[model samples]
Target: MFPLLEVLKSLAQLSLAQLSLAQLFTATVIIVLSPILTDRIAAVRSILFSNYQDYFFPQLTMIIEESDGFSQNQLYAAARTYVGVLFSVSRKPRHFKCRRAIKGEKLVFDFVGEDFYQKKDIAREDSIIANFEGIKLEWKSRAKINEHNGETVSKYFELSFDKRHEKKVLEYYIPHLLARAEEIRKEERVPRLYSRGGSGLGEWLSINFEHPTTFEKLAMDPTLKRMLKDDLDRFVKRKDWYKKVGRAWKRGYLIYGPPGTGKSTLIAAMANFLKFDIYDVDISSINSDLDLRKILLSTSNGSIMVMEDIDCARLEKGGQQNKASSAKFTLSGLLNVIDGLWSNCGDERIIVFTTNHKDKLDPALFRRGRMDVHVHMSYCTIDGFKLLATNYLKIEDDHQLYRQIEVLLANVEVTPAEIAEELLNSSGSSDDVVLARLVEFFEQKLHVKAKAAELKERLKSADIDVDAEGLVKFLKQKKLENAKEKEVEQLLNSGDTDIDAEGFVKFIKQKKIEDAKAAEAK
Candidate 1:
């Protein structure tokens, strides 16, 4: 046992000496390569590996920039969507920021970067690995600086994949990504209306369009409203039918009405119903034919272009020599723009023209296929009045004034705008007060009509040669005076007394005779 112990002690001492020599050799090597040589060795290794990779495993790269010319680049938007989708499904990324969406109920988390090489599987600025259908790709975000500008950070995304997978990436993967991105945008982004700012190409100013009007809120004839809704629905679903029929995928509408009617409101309803953007073009703002063309061509697909007060634009028959004294647009130029070759560029387009004076418009503007539909906005009927009553006062059917209001609306030529204004004013007040005010308005309208008729008969008996325009003006003056009389009578009645009937009749007769003489002299 003693001999065995001596042999074990000798072996332990030899091992201790060898371990000390190895430690000393390692210390010397570390001191030699501590600062600069360590960095040099790493640089040499990286250069060698990079050169080897370039020779053996070549890569294909695609760049998606943030802006193209004056417009936001589509691929950049797609890349954002792509990243968002990855973040939704990925459990690997640890450093992320949550983004509360502006329009939706869900929150989105976006990945951020620090030391890229710390985690091999996590997303970083230099590389983000993604797998699709057994194929792998790397996404990298980079910023390039401009020498002339002071640290201008122009960002872009670079997609790199093996050269062997280039065909699949270009053919199927990229298109799929674009389509998915578009779907996301449509579901999340609020729509905007765009218009040309000046003479530049693709220069657009955007406005958030959030019109609340819809077909159900529009106060019109029920049958006519249903027809319009059906027409619009059919137009939207008939893309293939339009192609088969060899017609442009477009429609035109001409809305004619008196002022204060629901022409503009109906346009809003249509826009909201279709989820389409509205391009409201002021005809007076257009300077020349070229300017008009530029505006028309800049409009995107699936949009409505509206021109209000078409008759006021003074569109005459002759091309450029017509007496369109107030407007710079010529008749031929307008017509060609509406139906010419340039209009064929876009799909799913709608053109709307609104005019208060349909009679004043040129006949050529309303030819066979130019305006596919003609809608007339007339005075509010009993149905329309009920709609307004329900909408404004929340009085569905229990009101005592509905019957009387219905009778008055049938005879009076008041517009929906006017009724809506009155109803809005009467809101939150007692129902009785609203009914009485509406009744008084109707009574005044009836009195004006009756007095105008009486004046016309008297003028005919007197053999006056007054034209229609002159007679209308004279009648308006009489109506104003009658309104004053009604106000005076109301004041008297409020005091528990009435005006002297005989005295009032005498005063009215004297005033009418004086106005008749004045009008005759004129």
Candidate 2:
């Protein structure tokens, strides 16, 4: 005690001017480390008094890489979403970074390296300590340069929690995180349409799908539209029902119609309504059954696989013989891939096939479970015409031409495509002029029908054996002529008669003669 008192007295006698440089530096170090020494003393006291089990409990850790077996690059996205949600609400971090992005003519802000929660020695980097149902968990993010490829970098997240909470984390907490991430992704990103690349390989090419057609905008019978929508709704809700029935959780639709009918339009509408990506499979481009399997396997769940003009794929029973000479895939191979065990691997998938001739398709393709729903897109009905009128001309049901258009629609087989084209052609004209033009077009279809009947009667009287194919060809030719005549009549009726009417008439006569000769040769 006497020696300590003498040392303190000697230190007090020294002033700032009398102190040496080394002594001043040591004093400054002591002053800077005083708080740290105090904290260390408090930590030692806590360790001495606290429960040993609580201080040394085992913590389970999980590391999630940017790429997973199921998704190539989803973990990073999930972590970003998780971190974004935390920073958005808490904003407890000291350091933050910002990124600028343009979204639809608006500038958006994004943040990174923002901490939501932290603890001594336990939480570091972009980490957050969260308590879910009283189970404390810590999430940390890390970035590292790839050892194999120095130029590339990879990222991951580490989740640490008490071992007692492992079950909850595996069963509920992780699933909750994934669901939240998906919700965020859906809100921020536009749906995409994926198609096979042109290289005849199985690679997919993605493009932003911007088709705006919905059920309300499609020109079809209201009853049919409602039925289709109901079918889709029921299918979406039948996931458990499908499992109970021991069937693949998928649906198939067959849309058969003429070229001008709205089969493709309905497909687009269905895609938009369901918010599903479209995988348009070009059957002709596929090289082999192996290639087909690869393509099908590469497609993700919740997508529509479309095969347009399926009848053109030559899917008849014995057509494999003809196909084998040049093609690499067989009819049976396609059928197996479509309905066999491989098809069951995907969930919430839809297969759609469109054709101009349903009768030409094989019976095997129409089996009970293969094509669950068959939609026939026929000629434009009055309801469809009215819908088109409202869409194209904003003419409601109370319009003066509604009655005339209804009456004409009942007798003619004009397609929605033709009607839409007519409406577009007359867009610059007055409402009355447009309606009048549609009336003239309908009248020309009536004229063509009358002429067709008259020709059939003449051919029957002449005892000509007209095959079904020949009759179909003849009718198609007349339909083409009807379209051309409608255009010519529109020009003449629009006060453009001064433009070579005689020469146009002669040209029409010459075309008819050539068509008749061609039909006879066929």
Highest TM-score against the true fold, candidate? 1
Error of 2 at 330 (Å): 2.5
RMSD of each predicted structure: 10.9, 10.3
lDDT of 1 at 26: 59
Per-residue lDDT of 233-335 in model 1, one digit per residue for the tens?
A: 9998999999999888888999999998899999999987777778878777776777677777667566799988988788667765346455687888888
lDDT of 2 by residue, 237-263 (tens): 899999999999888999999999999
Would you estimate the TM-scores of all the predictions?
Answer: 0.66, 0.63
Error of 2 at 155 (Å): 13
Clashing pairs in 2: none
lDDT of each: 0.74, 0.73
Name the best candidate (by lDDT).
Answer: 1
lDDT of 2 at 161: 93
Instruction: Write down the worst ten-residue block by lDDT for model 2.
Output: 112-121
Q: Candidate 1, overall lDDT?
A: 0.74
